[model samples]
Target: MSDTVVIRRSGQAGPTSEVVDISIPSDQVFERLVRDGAVAVARWLGFSEERLADMQLAVSEAVNNAIEHGNKNDAHSRVGVRFIVRNDRLAVQVVDQGTGLAASQLTEGRPSIQNKLDNGEESPRGLGIYLIEQLVDDVELQSDEQGHSFIMWFNLTTQGKEGVDEHHD
Candidate 1:
């Protein structure tokens, strides 16, 4: 149920980066894979414990949405995850095979769950997307003929050795 997935790119001059891809059939595996990627990326970025936990949670929710909603628990379809580390930030992309959402709707924050419930709606989604936006610097959702993808960017400047001096001085 658990595995260490590592992604690597060539021809980079600075700190090395990695991307781990996993195809998970079940919710349990999906959650674990995301957590593993988050841990790996956070460690690679030299993030503090708190930041690592945040990253893990954010990625976990993203993957869950891909599995539960996008793929609809279809075991045949696979979710693609890519993690990239650049000079100043870390980027994670989760792609799922499903009908995409309306881009405009996502851009304009949708009504919250409380609002929907107060209005007498039975169910509501998108709470995770809202949280992802708050947790990371950037979040983008895109879909084409192939599948739907959620791309998230976290600034390394907020964590680890590079930003530690800011607190001290």
Candidate 2:
């Protein structure tokens, strides 16, 4: 499926709530499109270059996980992304059509190379969730038998003249 994008604005004035909805086929080739769409919205909302890069990586990783892991790279499946734009923050939700992930899989722990080696794991992978959690201000993951939703938020109000702090509230 080709990319389908919808933008809705609640008001024409300053900092009104806006929404950008995008759906694409479960193909890695379309991952960049999703990332670009998110960055475009973030940029328009006055995100700093540093924060823009962070948002780009986090959004790309989420879409990649949705396409590769959730949909199992099935072209027929579709990944949906919804960006909610507000004055103080930007909230994004990426959904995929696949069997849900276990609750244990969505922990806040970051995998380490030493731990992987000690456990004799085949690969030192599974860092997407960790990266997303670190880059974004907040993250909440939900999944069931139907599908999985990776939702994250970024703070926009704090980064004024003082610049962004290390607060991930």
Candidate 3:
């Protein structure tokens, strides 16, 4: 199987930016890549403490899904992670080498009763996606004959306005 990976400026008028493209086999390296990428982006964007933690968690979860489900933890298969830092936004894409589910299949609710009765086979699966959606401003899933890609993005401008609030109780 062959994969095409590309990372460049959005090419649509913007401020200074950077892109990091990585291709790693599904293993511990995949997880480390995700963590390091999150840390680098957080530092570059000047993310506050809470925002940094949220971004780390969301990116880690997305990478976990890509490694565990998409690539089946196969050390041979590859996962692609792209970090795009635009003018006021940061977008991260995690692509895997497995068949993907359709966007229609992702709903904002708990598993259905029928799905639950299957001994929770699909119960713990969707939490990562759900948490990603909650943490990031936008989450998108795209798939074609090639493979599946999950994209998560956050607006740095809005985050700056909100500041960091660790204690909400």
Candidate 4:
């Protein structure tokens, strides 16, 4: 179960993937749909209740960010979320049709929300990213002319290797 899940998305380079793509209007109401559905799938795939919560929180943050920040709360714009689950890992991505996150934040390692507040960064930017970073095993960010994507990975094995961090409180 240490193997990585290969997900091949359009314009995304990776191995062949079994992707679950859900696109919704840029309204915040749609966030719950994606978060709940992903948690249900993760549970059906044998993840424990604890794991379900982790996925739920991370997905919630990503979806909220997509709708609020990335899509600028535009109901007409769309937010795309793709879930990929394999034997070894589960990867969730939230893509928005808006300007991406800053590249500098992507390079910083394990940035905490407190750091942002101390540094006087804008509200919730550091907080949301910090929460997602702490919840998942790994997070990947991509920025392009189209929009930004927040791709998060959850490991599914028990070899002490990273699958998911169930607790970040």
Candidate 5:
């Protein structure tokens, strides 16, 4: 499958909110497309440079999880990234076509890097969920038969908007 991106704007005159949705084949190379798309919306929302960096990392990890764990790197499968931009905040959702995670898995304690080393694991690589939570202002997970959706929110603070142009559409 190829990539598909859709942008939708709401409100009259000056739009109050915007939505950007991107779908791509389950390939690691395309993960950047989704991450960049979400970062663009966060930048438009006036997030600080530090926040932008955080968003980039968080989006990357989420997309990586969707591609590696969710889609199992199957090129025929698809992963979707959706960004909802509002005046006050930006919300992102990354979706995958896998069977989805169990509710218990969501509440499990954060993985410990030390434990991985002690257990002789090759790499401490299962920390995506923990890393994403630490970077974003807020995060949540939703799953059904369709798949898992990783939702993240980043709020725009007054300091963040200090120098940004006010005009937006």
Candidate 6:
């Protein structure tokens, strides 16, 4: 689908953002697929190879969170993703089929080493959220009775190359 792959563009009108969407069953097998898909698109957008590894990690963590925590590894569940392409950033939204996280589980900023240690929490939870926020430029979370969605973003530079752009329903 055209919406599944939107390329960058440049003109007198300046840069206009595009978006891509992806949906997959909530299974661990699809984690690699999502990681590779984001990698491919980021590479096409001319992101640094170093950034690729980090983005892959973040994508994997987010999708894995959706599958494991949100959907409880339910194979019948689905995870929806949307990639928003812009002149200087790429935003990805992964939606899972479950209620949202507690506000306390998220941090408004990067957790300090002291915070991580002194929080008095024995569990290794929230590590993924921390990693994702640290790896990307921004992260947003939203949820309702239907599901929860995590939107993560990173800076991008297509370097002003003329590329393909399409719109799909």
Full-model lDDT for every candidate: 0.70, 0.79, 0.74, 0.72, 0.74, 0.73
Stretches of candidate 4 above 4 Å error? 1-17, 107-125, 158-169
Number of clashes in model 6?
Answer: 0
Give candidate 1's TM-score: 0.75
Q: Write the per-residue lDDT of candidate 6 for residues 47-159, one digit (tens) a residue.
A: 76667767788899899989888888887788887777666778888888977564454684554566557886564567788888777777888878898888887767532
* Model 5 residue 35 distance off true place after TM-score fit, in angstroms: 2.3
Q: How accurate is candidate 6 locally (lDDT)?
A: 0.73
Q: What is the C-alpha RMSD of each candidate to the true structure, in Å?
A: 5.3, 4.8, 4.9, 8.2, 5.9, 9.5
Model 2: per-residue Cα lDDT over 1-169, one tens digit each = 2444434444455564677778888888888888888779877888876787788899999999898889999888889898886778888999988895634546647778797789987755668877887788888888987799988898886443235654558
Per-residue lDDT tens digits for candidate 4, residues 30-103, read 77778777876676566776767777888998888888878899887788888886557888888888874545
Where model 6 places Cα greater than 4 Å from the true spot, the runs are 1-15, 100-102, 108-123, 157-169
lDDT of 2: 0.79
TM-score of each: 0.75, 0.80, 0.76, 0.72, 0.80, 0.72
User: Which prediction has the highest TM-score against the true structure?
Assistant: 2
Colliding residue pairs in candidate 6? none
Q: Alpha-carbon error at 26 in model 1, in Å?
A: 5.0
**On lDDT, who's better, 2 or 4?**
2
Tell how far residue 6 is off in model 2, in angstroms: 7.5
Pairs clashing within candidate 3: none
Model 3 regions more than 4 Å off: 1-16, 102-105, 110-123, 160-164, 167-169
* Candidate 3 overall lDDT versus native: 0.74
